[model samples]
Target: MFLPIGQVKKTGLSCHLKWFEQHEILPLYKAGQFPNALCARFIPERPDVLAVAAYDGSKIIGMAGASADTPIMWQIGIDVEKNYRGRGVGTYLVTLLKNEIINRGKLPFYGTSLSNLHSWNIAINSGFIPAWLEVETVEQENYYPCN
Candidate 1:
């Protein structure tokens, strides 16, 4: 899930985002709002540098995170509420986050297993192509298990 930094396009949808940084986002992370974006705990290499959350009144519906995995690239992880599926919330948030990372002078990329169609669609819809797949030697690895 790589969005090539320069190609990030803002969705321009009217999304009201409240930003959060490390430690300040504990409540949301504990609630599992965006587990993929925010790690279970903070660490130096992959700190959750920034997060953009969408809300309905006061309830958070979805979140997109930019985790600094490396000095040159950041990884994006997004999760939308089950009740909000098919509503473009994931796409909107991803687009917003990706562009924001670029603005911050870092390359933003998304990552998810190939089996996750829902997440894959969100990446594609957010204008990120399947940049690369990294694998390691494993015993009986089941590639494309969704099949």
Candidate 2:
């Protein structure tokens, strides 16, 4: 289940938000500056993957992207450059990306580790609420029931 969150607000940062294009944004991915998740998913092969990047001048400062996990649901991910972090870049990117996804008739969702307060804060600030938790057993054969 997914919980509805509030709308996204404008961020007063002086940066440009642009849709991700393979020829343009692929260099950033190849530069190895982005987080692993961003690098892994920001590919041209998957048309369902979409991204919005925040640029400071000609440099990319942050990115928020989504991958369609299902026909109706998309999973969101984000990364901000170390030097540009904590300045609302993540929140701005996420807000823009989330709104774009919604405008395209899809649901956007986010997930992060419990210990990552920074990510959690970004999610909330960008209009997401705690809705569900995911758990899995990697080694099902080795698991035993305890009574």
Candidate 3:
């Protein structure tokens, strides 16, 4: 999905996910908590930028991340612990991240596997319309399920 640069709303919803800069979130992704699909290297040139994490005290239960696919376009992905699945954590964090991206003057979009209906729903709940399909080649190490 993609959003035209001019359509990013000036104001949007807020939430309690902990925000982190690209540098801060890289280590977490590398720590083996997130799977290969969510690894920062999945799309090397995309440049992971911001991440929002939801926690139960100090334990991270859910996370959503954004990467700059271009100067004005950013893409997002999410990961929620199995125990936390079906809850609203993913949607809230994604929505918060989307709003933050828009507030920062960039367009936010989400692309997910066709079989992953839950993820697609989260994107819709986060206000991302199904603009188009996005396909990209990935290294073997970046396409496996690593968890």
Candidate 4:
């Protein structure tokens, strides 16, 4: 579910959030500094991928982007520079991006490992609540099928 925009907290640090257009996204992608996971899933060439970046003056300090997984579902991801972390960058970016996605008539969701408390906190602080758990298992070649 999408949370109300007014509930999201503003970043403590001085920065501006900008929704990167396709032209801007391409340069960031080519620079090889965008989040690897986001790049792997959301190619810049794809129209379904959208990005919102946090800039501290001329430099990009954080990014929150989403890619459509289905007609209505979009997966969101965030990345913050090491020096800028712990200053509410992640929370601000995700919250801004999430609201933007929702405004576009799509659903945005986040996923993180249980052990990663930092990520979990960012999600919660950004107005995301626990939704569903996901797991993956590999099948052995020698395993027999029971019918």
Candidate 5:
């Protein structure tokens, strides 16, 4: 299949929220992880928020969602399909998201597990630095059985 042209668009709150729940949120949930990423797409509308997708036809191969917590603070999360990885899609997605964040008068912030080198590289390429780091422990109460 040909690489789909990636474009950044301003999505409506209701439509974007549904997209997030289906395309982004479910992945994390299936991984036995809670929804850590802030949902920028919601009803009632948040003017300082933006939701981006890298679509190939009607399929969303990747997504980047973020919101401005304050005039100076913004946080972003990215998700790209496995087959689409290593093809610079994540980098493109984040770069577009960062530009949108900056345009809205906020500094972009991103975080990933230390072992996620691919994600780290993308963030660095997008001009972000580690604001802070921490190790997490998953106790049984929050654990899911490994298949």
Candidate 6:
């Protein structure tokens, strides 16, 4: 599997969210929730927010993203299509993104649901050690973006 860094162009927020939703990984898309403008905004105008797309020639089979909120604190996220799992795409993406994070003088890390063995394994394979964890739930009626 080849992990290639995607172009850091200003992609539409909705477009990226659509990709996640299409995979059923992002069940909810609250305006202030995961991948929201706030989350993407948290990442400044720099390559700090690494967005890489796994490709089979021209088709995107998977994706991985990361950002460093602070000098030494970073967060990473990844996903692969259902039919593309177990082919090392996820692992490769994570590894490539992790290296990119480190290159920017930040620590590469990830957080996943305890029930997701695949995510856990990918994190481990990408050289991220489980250092800590926390959980939270918020009640909100306005989920997706109003626009």
Best model number under TM-score: 1
Ten-residue segment with the worst summed lDDT in candidate 6?
A: 9-18
Per-residue C-alpha lDDT of model 4 across residues 25-80, encoded as one tens digit per residue: 65665566766225643354433377888888889888887766676877777888
Candidate 1 lDDT over 51-135, as tens digits, reads 9888888888888888889987889998888998788888899888887778888888889986889988888888788879866
| Local accuracy by lDDT, each model | 0.80, 0.74, 0.73, 0.72, 0.57, 0.56
Write the number of the candidate with greater lDDT, choosing between 4 and 6.
4
- The count of residue-pair clashes in candidate 6 stands at 1
Stronger candidate by lDDT (1 vs 3): 1
lDDT of 6: 0.56
How many collisions per candidate? 0, 0, 0, 0, 0, 1
Query: Looking at model 4, how many pairs of residues clash?
Result: 0
TM-score: model 1 vs. ground truth: 0.83
Predicted structure with the largest lDDT when compared to the true one = 1
Model 1 local distance difference test score: 0.80
Candidate 5, 50-73: lDDT as tens digits: 556666666666777664555566
TM-score of 5: 0.60
What are the TM-scores, per candidate, against the unseen true structure? 0.83, 0.77, 0.76, 0.77, 0.60, 0.60
Which residue pairs clash in candidate 1?
A: none
Number of the candidate with higher lDDT, 1 or 4: 1
lDDT, candidate 6, 45-66, per-residue tens: 4223455666666655667765
Error of 4 at 135 (Å): 1.4
Rank all candidate structures by their lDDT, best first, as comma-separated numbers: 1, 2, 3, 4, 5, 6
Give candidate 4 misplaced runs (Cα > 4 Å).
Answer: 1-13, 41-48, 138-147
lDDT at 117 for candidate 1? Answer: 92
